[model samples]
Target: MAGPYWFARNIRAGYVGRDRYGKGVMPIAWQGRAVIAGFVAAMIGGGATMFLLFFYAHQMALGVVIYVILVIGGAGTFIWAVATRSDPDKSLAVYLAERQRARSTGR
Candidate 1:
């Protein structure tokens, strides 16, 4: 079965090939993992928030507190996604150039 395409291809080629300085970190994979992790965390957080709202339904102040917490959590998730930006095409270009140079030098 064909899988989702990343960076216009799904080949198992390691761009940057794990440099010592870790500068070659592939942002595509990291971004995907971060999104998945964030979604899961959000789901759990929403559930917990709902539970708290239900538990404290008798108190109007508690409900308001829960609403604020949920709103803040949701905003935090959005901000986190924005903060963890990724540009895989540039990384792929670097990888290709390095490979070409290595092959040309017979390394």
Candidate 2:
């Protein structure tokens, strides 16, 4: 899951998370609302794609269309979320600070 991978990488690099993640798990912050629908669409599209690859290979065109739509929708939602956020640059700043701190501590 590239979404989760990039998210975890950003978190580890201190690019996000103003609040701490409970239970040692942190989900992508799509403004806290679209996460559910996003999850469902991603899971269903991916699962259907895999299932089609095995049983009904001929139906792969349909699966590809559905999967593409899901990806586009997810990307659109992420863009929208960024547009609505007031302090998107804060995370970038935090990331830079973390990098500087790490460099200083290393030397």
The superposed Cα distance between candidate 2 and the true structure at residue 96, in angstroms, equals: 15
lDDT score for residue 68 of model 1? 67
lDDT of every predicted structure (CA atoms)? 0.51, 0.50
Total colliding residue pairs, candidate 1: 0
Candidate 2 — which pairs collide?
none
What TM-score quantifies how close candidate 2 is to the native fold? Answer: 0.41
Per-residue alpha-carbon lDDT of model 2 for 13-106, expressed as tens digits?
Answer: 5333654322222223443345446756776877678567647776776766777777777767655544444233333335456657878899
TM-scores of the models, in the given order? Answer: 0.35, 0.41
Regions more than 4 Å wrong, model 1: 1-27, 55-57, 88-107
Model 2 — which ten-residue stretch has the worst lDDT? 1-10
Worst 10 residues of 1 by lDDT: 1-10
RMSD of model 2, in Å?
Answer: 11.8
